[model samples]
Target: MRKITAGVFISLDGVVEAPDQWHFPYFSDEMGAAVDATLGAADTVLFGRKTYDSFAGAWPEREAAGEEDAGFAKKLGDARKIVVSTRKLEFTWRNSEQLQGDFVEAVTALKNEPGGNIALSGSISVVRQLLAAGLLDELQLLVHPIAVRKGMRLFDEGDTAVPLRLLSSETFQTGVLNLIYAPAEPAADAGYEDAKAHLPQS
Candidate 1:
């Protein structure tokens, strides 16, 4: 099965939204390389309506303008773009399509199809849904050093806990951390007696 990897630029306090306001000062060559690696592995891109709108508004324009990021913009424009939304959308972007029907069923079917990794970026709602459905294979976070103190976070208050195991991590020179994780089986619950042996002796 093709792996589904979700990559997000997160703040130190777990904020994931509006990275443009707080993320660029910390961007470095290392971070660029890390992002390039993820995009390099995936031939398809997944987006929620919000992210799709944001990207569709910008990338094509950037590519057309021949900006510094024009190559990356071109890559995104060339990739198969799948937007997950309940409302009908007119996709003017090339190679773009809307994902219809049941969200989980449709995405599960997409996962089973033979293809390269399906990469998702900047789509917080979609990521949560994928995590809840157990459909996400990897969660790659580039944790920046600063905190905006107020924004939509990756996980909200009273959300159900989802256990994840760190697959790997790397520290960039700019104090950013690239953390890769995968869903993990819940740890067995244990009472005080289970840890008594490891307690400090007086």
Candidate 2:
């Protein structure tokens, strides 16, 4: 069973949206390398429709030729992606599929499938849903030092603190901190879900 890793590049105030604003500068190399590590370990990427659309438009251009391209964005175009969007959008990337129905059903089925870890990018809506469904296995946070006064946040209005144990923590030379967390395994519960649950038939 592959882990479901939630990867995020957030600010001091937990903003995960565009960081290229006049005041909020983009992430540095240290942050990039840490995020790249998580992307490298994943065989699949999962996102909501909004994130998929945002990424799809930019990743292809970056993959081919872009000055701001990173290692992860390049691999993103080629990795297996599952987009859970209900807005009736289309997918253009190869090995990409749209999950249109119930978010829980679609995400649960994806989790039960046989594959490597499912990495999540910037999809706060989807992340909240997944978090509520208790499907995320690991969390990789690349925390930058700057704080944006206003922007889209990663947490939902109803979201509360979920207990997590830090598996690893590292700080890079560029002042970015890498924090890897795993959900707290209950004393009696065998991990979170039954590992034997088979994937829903395609």
Candidate 3:
């Protein structure tokens, strides 16, 4: 089965919203390479309606205008784009389509089919749903050093705790962390007895 991976630009405080407001200051060649690697590994891209709208509104025009990042825009344009949405959408971009049927069932079916990896970016809700459903294979976070202090967070209150194992980590030149994680089995709870050994002796 193909893997479903998610990448996000997040602040130290876990804010994942409006990265364009604070993300560029920390961009470096190292960070760019990390992002490129994620994009390079996927043949398909998944998006929530909002993210789809943002990219669809920009990338096609960027590719047509032959902007400096036109190559990247073209790459996105050429990929298979799947948008998760309830309302109907007119997809003007090539190879783009709205997800049909139930979200989990549809995505599971896509994973079971023969294909390269599926990549998701900037879709906080979609990522959360996938993680909750145990369908996300990996989560790649480009964690910036600053704390936005107020915005949408990657993990919210009342969310069921999902255990994750650190698969890999890299510190970029700008102090941003490239952290990769995979879903993990729930760890056994630690009680006072488990911590007693490290308690200070009077």
Model 1 TM:
0.94
Could you tell me every candidate's TM-score relative to the true structure? Answer: 0.94, 0.79, 0.95
lDDT of 3 by residue, 169-198 (tens): 999989999999999999898998999999
RMSD of each: 1.6, 10.8, 1.6
Q: lDDT value for candidate 3? A: 0.93
Judge candidate 3 at residue 160 and give its lDDT. 74
Error of 3 at 82 (Å): 0.2
Task: Output the lDDT of residue 188, model 1.
Answer: 92
How does model 2 fare in lDDT?
Answer: 0.75
Ranked by lDDT, top first: 3, 1, 2
Which has the better TM-score: candidate 1, or candidate 3? 3
> Of the candidates shown, which would achieve the greatest lDDT relative to the real structure?
3
Model 3: per-residue Cα lDDT at residue 183: 99
| Stretches > 4 Å off in candidate 1 | 191-193, 199-202
The C-alpha lDDT values of all candidates are: 0.91, 0.75, 0.93
